[model samples]
Target: MEVIAIQKSTLEGMKNELKELLELTENATQKYAPIFKEEKWLDNQEVCLMMNITKRTLQTYKDKGLLPYSRLNRKNYYKLSDVQALLKAGQPYKSNEDGVIDQ
Candidate 1:
């Protein structure tokens, strides 16, 4: 049996490098995670892309009052928080007049 001896200083240096790498990995994961907790406004195009729905469906949702939105001029904006909340509700759309899901 042969033992390849590693020096103490080299071991200490490796340990420090490992620690720094771990910290960097953690920071990167936090910065680029799949889910974002912060609330922000989304435009119609952004909302469509995120929800995987068509633009017409988005308008239908707005008209049916399923998704809450804000209008300025001809453009509409929705809150990311509200959309996430509705998704989390997991309820069927109960529409007397095409009812939107409960949020």
Candidate 2:
């Protein structure tokens, strides 16, 4: 009976661990807080993440005329509309919403 109790406790602990892991994953997957997908355009950081590039790379794209962007008070920005257009140009993307590349 003691052995059975120990096994049961171990199983419960593992279950709790699994639950925590799942919660962590869920939170990570929801890392992005979409506050402007419906009402406003996207910013530089959002476009950078969407294209899997950095802010400097974004500036390069802007300079190359490959991507449209703007600057306000020294802060650069990219519009969601522009991102959609770039996608049409075959810029390549992982996924539209999730930003996950296909493996």
Number of the predicted model whose TM-score against the real structure is largest: 1
Residue by residue across 1-103, what tens digits does model 1's lDDT show? 9988999999999999999999999998898564434557789999877765666667767778889998769898888887787667742343233443333
All candidates: CA RMSD in angstroms? 11.9, 13.4
Please, what is the TM-score per model? 0.48, 0.45
Whole-model alpha-carbon lDDT for candidate 2: 0.68
Per-prediction backbone clash count: 1, 0
Where model 1 places Cα greater than 4 Å from the true spot, the runs are 1-39, 91-103
Cα lDDT for residue 67, candidate 2: 84
